[model samples]
Target chain A: MTRDDLDVDPDELYGRLKAYEGRTAASGGTGRDPVNEPMIRHWCEAMGDTNPAYPAVAPPTMLQAWTMGGLAGHPGGSARSEAYDELLALLDDVGCTSVVATDCEQEYPRPLRPGDRVTFDAVIESVSPRKTTRLGTGYFVTTRMNVRAGDGELVGTHRFRILKYAPARPKNAPKPEPAPKPGLTADPARRPRPVINRDNAGFWEGVARHQLLIQRCLDCATPRFPWLPGCGACGSLRWEAFEASGTGTVFSYVVMHHPPFPAFDPPYAVALIELAEGVRMVSGITGVPYDKVRIGMPVELEFLRVDEELELPVFRGAEA
Target chain B: MTARTGDELPPLRIPITRTLIVAGALASRDYQDVHHDAEAAREKGSPDIFMNILTTNGLVGRYITDHFGPRARLRKVAIRLGAPNYPGDEMVLTGQITSVAEGTAEVAVIGKNGIGHHVTGTVTVQLPSDAPGTTDASRTDAPGAIDAPRTDAPRTATTPDTPR
Candidate 1:
């Protein structure tokens, strides 16, 4: 109930939280609303997904969306049990009051469609022992929810996990800097590496030689970028390295900003370049402002020496 | 039509904004205080209201289908979350085709935000039969046939088939 309750034994508290494992978090729960087109439209709109397959059958990912109880808190009635409540209350009493959802995994055996009445039952799958994180020390509470249709046919299962933790620093303390994440560094040596394997090793070798190579199916003559072993056009396994003209146009691109990583500058451009050979590759776009890099902008290929150990084939676009 | 083994989809950059975060949560019917209430989120240890898992799932599904085409049916999506997707950050989603059989393909997807990877998972998508690169025998043409219109993202390479 208060920070004064800090005297609670860690082991005892963890044991109590762990006791709720396997208990029903929700049972015989009917969705407050059935799967419908409006929600699907909203979801698609918010996500900027324009796939026409939607509004006919719901997105499989929406399996859990239909079962969510929003701000109104399951207006029909509470399908949640007191065990989950008591669990959270227990954590709150010890000042582990902050809660952040950390993970979710869902499997859809069948597609959910509009007009299907949804029902679900959830159980407290597991509770981890108290662990400290950059966010703070707390237990990870995981729940598995089985969503079904009105006919009782299981549609999907959603596993959701949350970290119920005490803030690592008090609110009154000096503002804490963003936590350092792994694989993020200012050191040039820590730059992200490309995945190299036998199939594409030759492509990297070409980059090392300042020769931009596109894989061509020797059998069909179809050229492919990113160097796949077989041809999608003819299914030919036979291929050869063909030199590119080093000319391309930006097909699409994005500007990176936020959560700065030390190895690179922020607000830079990453582009999908369509080669004159009719193949496309994703690489860094240089010589242009992040915002000025537009679709159809002409660019020329260049091998950028990222570090002593690596050379990447990036494209240079003209500044607008 | 180029959904094939070992093929990589072009990365999609998603700008993280408060509107997108709150809209996504609301759209998913997730009304958790930490997802829409910034003060409440900070109180709960997050610097800001963060994206919800359902939203992340939705985004992942969208990412796959955006490249594979509209008719692509997602059979299964198994993902593990890593870092939080806070507002003011961006998530770049990159996917690689890992396996292909018959008319179905499995892709390994990673969504990395400012701090680190926000989500890592694999998606199994059922490509339309007439779709390009549907393994053996569906190969409709040869060589210059590469310019055939496809259902996938525009201008992306049709890295059709790789050794199964």
Candidate 2:
């Protein structure tokens, strides 16, 4: 099919978007919360950032975090203009539906202190014509946000860019293929082996024998997976292996499709299974199609012998 | 040793997991479905949910501060994303001090995963005049020093290919 077959008039779309440039994307938008220590603490804990500078003055990089609307969305319903919505809808109408953030540039002029209220304004800086990117063909939309403290002092400026595009069609639909037979010369296309070491060697040994193991703290009896050297609960270095009952529920799952790997096929379900023992482990979910996998699905452990040298612990649902 | 133009920071290998991806997004307060909802991500044409730019920004910030000490102020951070960071993968972050002048150093950083380079950028950090090691020492008694800052000289990874 030619470019015209996609039903997109490149010139007309470009001309339509030109009027949106310099238009206000957001005006007088208030932050969801004032700069405070608790939110800063949460962010630091999650990022493993223990910088002593935090909980004093907020991290300079967190300038935009204050402005985000949570799962409930912005209280005043987005605080963005109708023109911005219309602009995005225009792209969607032309089959450019996928969107990915490509770049961000931020400048922090001054520290954001605790109890500081923030407000911001954003303008649609520019919009590029349809261009093909490694991810797909889409238009690059850039917006500039000016963040100000309650005192009306400009604290930071953020330039955000996103690519709204149609995803590239896969060369071939991904099919679930059986593991390659045992081979020689170190097949690069084979599944990557799990890294085994002194701390976790026992768990792998259990897997080879078709037994799923969870580390148990000898002192506190807390069970943990992705075996750690010490128990997080009791801080004990001594531990014993507790064999799992092999049944669990899918706490969460994802389907892999992009940047395909050599050893594994695409469109496969990788689930975080919560075992009956109350510990979670990351493994492949078998016996069901990728789309069929769901959170809370019941599953049972099974040893998948992918090759002569490798056998992995995988879970299969009841349907399989 | 003071940071020079050619100083190479140590490499950090991070295990990318679903927990980290979700936690990072929540930490950033980004409620975008593609960052956490796999089914929604697939419906939007992605094979899986991926990391958000804000999380990537946080990680990049952590990389710089982890090496340059807490006192090092970040003047600017500009990055461009390439390959997406999906679960069940690993990202290795490496950096080099491309230039150092007037208490500021420009570090060029690259984070690569199994697919390819996930993020490429330059971080402008304001290091003390003497060095990051000495600067971290004087603040050991600061009220919120939580834990001692890492004052060790950057250790270059001899075997970059080894999995963590």
Candidate 3:
């Protein structure tokens, strides 16, 4: 259904939406919690990111957390402007009642320290004209928020965008594609290729020859996978290519499904393999359905000829 | 992770899972049902549970700092989401050092999902005074078979996060 269902004039509606371009979306909101270590720890643990620089300060990404209203949202309606709600209501008055958040951009001027208090004010930055997406036709609503600390320090700026539109009609059933094969071939655009450069050319060469190799720093005796030119632990260019045992366990994994790519199937598991030698590398896994791929599962490396021109190192479930 | 201007940051691959979406949402105190409940997501017109913006923001931050190392400070992280990162999808994050000047470097980043770009933006990082100045000869950081860090060339790939 299009705007025919609603009696609002196109020009009038567009004018009304445009009128809110610079209007305040929300303002004068205080964070429910201060920048603290517990939330930082939980966030890092969930993301599997363990950079030592955190907790002393919050993750740069957590720039929005300090200003969130939580499950119930902002304490009151004091911050939100009536115009923002009116624009949304007008969109809903039409047939576009569905909503999906598209993306967000955050700019941090300074990291938030543990004791800093955060306050913010947000504005309706812009409202896009009617647009069509893979999901459906809708307008993109963007909000710009400025966050500050207790001492009036500008901590960060966050711009968040969302699409409020009616979802597209689902299509009729299409023929099922064949299961992913060892020699699946398609246009090169659809397949991911290894970046071959001088720094790690040897690693790719080893893969072509069916050898899994890791870089070992001769100066520090430390082994690293994914071939770096120098050892980060010790600044050393002296290194040698070490053959890997081709055996490892799935330290963690994710099953991919969308932002669909051509010639590739979704709901497949991509796993991080921690080799028996104690280094980790990312690769694909087979032999089990995506949901069954789990951490601690044993896997062995196998070179798969993905396409005529491409051969990749993949892992196979060692058991089951 | 540390490089001169025009160097490509090592790519980071993160698999978008139901567990990741829910845990990230809850962890960030975003209790929206769409991020954690498949049925709720379906009701919201999504195929399944999808990732929330807060989680995406967190991951992007992690991606930058992980490559630049702990000392690299994020002066600004401006990201725009393109695709909905639902469960069972993988995000390959790739970036390049667009410029470096006055103790700061601007990195242009694009995160593509299986279908296409999920997020695209620039990150301005305040490099530490005593950081390593890695030359182009080194900096291998991909499961990089598919994604060599984008140099001056027009490269469109990233690191691997899974064995498959």
Candidate 4:
């Protein structure tokens, strides 16, 4: 439909958007554990980084995980607010349906650590109506979230682009082809297994037994993976282990054109997979076409036996 | 200590003030009271308004553009934030040349707020290394040709009331 065909009131839209901001402000905080340390370690390891500063001082992109506290606890405070949900409801009240996150840009003033309580206040930054798409026509709302500490220090800011669609298209798109099943055959010869470094030896050991284990900080109870010396939260040297479901969604992915190491295959799909436990792991995707990979697609972990002594953990599309 | 080739860039020092901080906050649509309101910030434990990372990035980009000129294109930027850049804090942006290609230069950039290297990252930019040439004058009109008045053609209307 043309812009003229839609008779939406600008004042009504502003009121609804204002109410959304009010609700989000009242949410107080998500209170969730930000950033999983072991996951960060695993990612760093996969990238072949030896920088001491990452685990010691976490990065801003990794800080998004720390906002999970509101989702973990009871339905009070931030959990009750459901800022995005309320915004979506308001959009519905204004005669719109179907919303999807399109893009996001975030900035950090300080690296987030464990024990630091964070509260997020988001506002509907702007909204612009767009022409029809494959999914039909609607408005694109850009919401900006400002994260702060318990004492009100600015931690970071995130800008999320959400597309509010008109109610003509299907809610769920058709599923893609399933990934090939893991091969059960074992290679007879034994190859020298890659040595796990001081940081990630525990994780490799857990993988040997077909168990997906995550690292947890003993001090603040924050769970992480790709093990490291000290906890990301309290900076304590002590940590423990917790198992994870070998399932996740592809947060992001890239195909390698160059092999950094002898063991890694060229043109392999490397993806940032968000686990069922709310942690994200950087792993390779196997048994699927590289072009078919999409963010938020369901994937399951598969252990590929490279040799008798080594089994590499990879992922494949989940079967229906 | 001497700076190494691949070492982090030396930090640049910029005075933190409401003007810079507010310009940055508004540019990024980050209207958080802590970033602009001094009294509210004081109530929240912050000494003064702090600059958002986006603004820092923009300023860094501007600095690079100023040094390189307008034709230079920014390819990529990856920055990591470190400390709070409070008002009156010395903001420093440091960088080092990481790699140089035929037409591109990659530099690792970092920003410091005095306490330490508050932010660290990298940027790649494309520059015009060669000078412009005047080889093809026939294909297009030469510069100042169209606007130049004809010497022998006509001189008219020195005064509005007099006819040529």
Candidate 5:
């Protein structure tokens, strides 16, 4: 969409921005949205993170969500604005027909939790024209969202790149080179056989019994991994292991092109699965084509004997 | 007058600096020049490269873990960054016990730059309050409770056609 097609008024955007700024300042340095337990749980579940470091402690990403103002009665109306729809309307006015989310990167200093009030200040970082492929010429607009708590403490920041194209392309241009893989890997021979760390011994033991186990601190009753000697809550030294249904959905995933380890084959699918018990875990996807892995797809847990003493948990498509 | 019965826990303090900023950046975040590059940050209208929220959160976590000792598992910690923390700014993190229930204590946390409050949040931690072995093992069964072995049946071991 061209600038001319956008019906949005600069004055209105400024007004909203200023109003948001004022509200945050008024909140006594608290986030417009309060971090709570449910939100933390949702984020942890989405990431499939069982690290006790997370639920045991508030996960870092959880802070990101908390700093993000709520849907209504919050700090910035930008997020509340039907951002895509508004862009579309502006594009339609400018005579552009399509837009796409090209890239986004978010950075955090720490995680957010309940009681911290945060505010977000956003600006159009840049807007530049781009060459067209199958789609018409387009412009990429980057917006930077700066977040801080009510007292003006820096929280985190996010950059979102939105590409507005005219008439839209039927398909994206193919890249000359493949995308890079994510996560760490090691050689099969050199790879440290995934050992059951002190924090996760109960989990491995459960796997030996063909039962999926999760760690819960007896103190706060939070479930997470890398079991600590004491509960994260109240520092209680009590913990409990419980069984899981071993069923979940792939919340997010990636296929590795470069093998980081010898034990791992190229083009393996790694996923964050949200299990039935309201927790998420990172594991490999097997028994299906890598392309079949998609967010929100049903999966069930299975075990792989990585070595004589270790068993690695993997997932596959569950029977409908 | 009813007698006050409990002892107030000592407040916790944590220092925030450029080192924390680098650690947060190394973790793969893309906020921008203001977080690490001071010169670029000045051009972007910031007094200095301000601390990223992610690092702030990490620091808060570090503060609690440091005080509780490594064995003390952090159950939950939440913080909201209030002001822009420049490289030289010293952040004082403080926490006070709010309540104790079922062997757990909740602490209200706040971080100040000496000028004003920079962050405020809460943390719930599990202390060594319960009797040994009295902990429930069933609590660990939540999905994603801990790392587990993969469930997919292993693919047939076929030699790759391409020699390594």
Candidate 6:
């Protein structure tokens, strides 16, 4: 809507963004709380993680958690340098207003423990020249934050990226592409294998035997699916395996229609099935149209063995 | 291993499943219903629950580190999303080293899924400076080292709607 007013010079804008690189984006920011239990608990609960090492230690994946400004940033904590704002305004002026995060790379040199005071400073790492994406054309801006503890030990480095782009002209609700005809889009010759290794080999071994197994914690009896070596709930390496009943309720489901992978047909339904044993695992839903798959739908497991090498557990709608 | 500027890093195939999609989102503390709820996503104009950009970003980082090994650390990774990776789609990641100087290598990377390219960007990594007994042959034969380090030109996409 706003591009009509300006005769934009693409190179000048690119030059402006490049100039903002390596500037101080923010500094002297402190986490509102010490790396503590409440936030850790919230993260684990939402993640369905039962790893035993949490609370005492944060998940390495939470490297950027402490630096988040949240929905309403704190009064003084929203202090970004003027150059950062000007660069964003320059992008905004050129109609690259819609922003979406692209990627992040975090390196943790030390594990953050509870009560470790979190303080961080960030620098405008780098800004890219004009790049186009399916979402729209935009510039990629990156920021690198070095997080340290109150004790002054380096905790981690978080490099975050975002693409500020103009929204693409809406395709105006195009018709869902029809599944390819058999001769047009032939099925893949073979199903791909899961990344199987020492850590989760036992789970696949159980699948090979046609037994749906849940890893049960020896200390807490908590049943977890997609097996883990140690229990997250109580932090115990001691665990036993139990056979699942293969009956489940569709906790939630989606009908996939795009970016058609060779191994799958479009418009197929995938469901998060809550097993009768009280754990959830994801699998394809069968015996019904993708649209008809509903939340709370009862389904039973059916292991579809594709070709000689691959066998996967899918769910079929169960009779009333 | 000595790398030329155009030397293609081996591609990494990642299966896009409901679980992988959801797990990657949750791991990043992204609780947007659009990521986990299909009905919610449909209301917001998506055909299905799509993988979030954060997950796509994390995967891009994983691909870079996996190729260069532990000695190399990512100094920066910039990416843009293209096609939405839905359940049952597989993403194939490919990259080529564009420049190398002073133990720093710039790589151009893209991840293509069943439909089209899911992401494209550049990753700059700090390779181990102490590469023992480095020779002129070990220096990448590709263009764009620090001396002539210019930003990558915009890439043209094969698909009309694919991200470049």
Alpha carbon lDDT at B43, candidate 1: 59
Per residue, candidate 3 scores C-alpha lDDT tens digits across A1-320 of 22222345667777778989999987777787788998889988888778788889889888877776678776654466687778888888775777777767777777888888898888999999877776677788999999999777888888888888765643222322322222234333448777899998999899889999899999999998778888988989999988999999999998875445565665589999999999999999988777689899999999988888899999998655
Candidate 5, A1-320: lDDT as tens digits: 22232334545543433332212111222344465555555544332233455444355444445543333434433343344335445545554555444433455554555666676656565555443433245556666666686467666666655556554322232221211112223223433655558777777778888788877777688876444567655777787888878889998998874313444544468898888877788888878777678888899888977777677778987533
The lDDT of model 3 is: 0.75
Q: Over 4 Å off in model 2, which ranges?
A: A1-5, A170-320, B129-164
Candidate 4, residues B1-164, lDDT tens digits: the string is 11123644333345555566775565344556766887555443334556665555555654343334444445555554445566544555656667766556677665554344445566665544431111332433434222222232222211122110
* lDDT (CA) per prediction: 0.80, 0.79, 0.75, 0.56, 0.53, 0.70
Interface RMSD of 2: 6.7
DockQ, cand. 6: 0.06
TM-score of chain B of 3: 0.78
lDDT of residue A111 for candidate 4: 59
In candidate 2 the C-alpha lDDT for residue B144 amounts to 33
Give lDDT tens digits, candidate 6, residues A1-320. Answer: 11222237878878888999999987877875678787777656444344455668775556666765654564575656677888889988887766666666666677788888888888999998787654567888999888999777888887878878765543344534432222235555465779998768888888899988789999998888788888978989898888889999999988775444556756588899999999999899888878688899999988988778889888998634
Scoring each candidate complex against the real one, what DockQ results?
Answer: 0.25, 0.20, 0.25, 0.01, 0.02, 0.06
* lDDT leader: 1
Instruction: Please write out the lDDT profile of model 2 over residues A1-320, one tens digit for every residue.
Output: 11222467789889998789999988888888899999899888766677788989887778779888878877868878788889899989987887899888888788898999999999999999778765568889999999999789999899999998876643243522222222223355678878889999999999878899999999998999889999998799989998999999999999875445667655488999999999999999889988789999999999998988999999998763
Error at B108, model 2, angstroms? 0.9
Q: Compare the candidates by TM-score and give the number of the best one.
A: 1
Question: Which of candidates 2 and 3 is the stronger one according to lDDT?
Answer: 2
Error of 5 at A151 (Å): 39
Model 5: runs farther than 4 Å from truth? A1-320, B1-13, B28-31, B71-75, B128-164
- After superposing candidate 6, which stretches have Cα over 4 Å from the reference? A1-7, A45-50, A75-77, A170-320, B1-49, B53-83, B86-164
The digit string of per-residue lDDT tens for model 1 on A1-320 reads 12322447988888888899999999889887888899999999888787788999898888878887877868767778789989988988887887877777777888888889989999999999887766677788999999899689999888888888787767655444544423345334368888999989998888889999889889988898777778999999998898899999999998875334557666588899999999999999878778689999999998888788888889999765
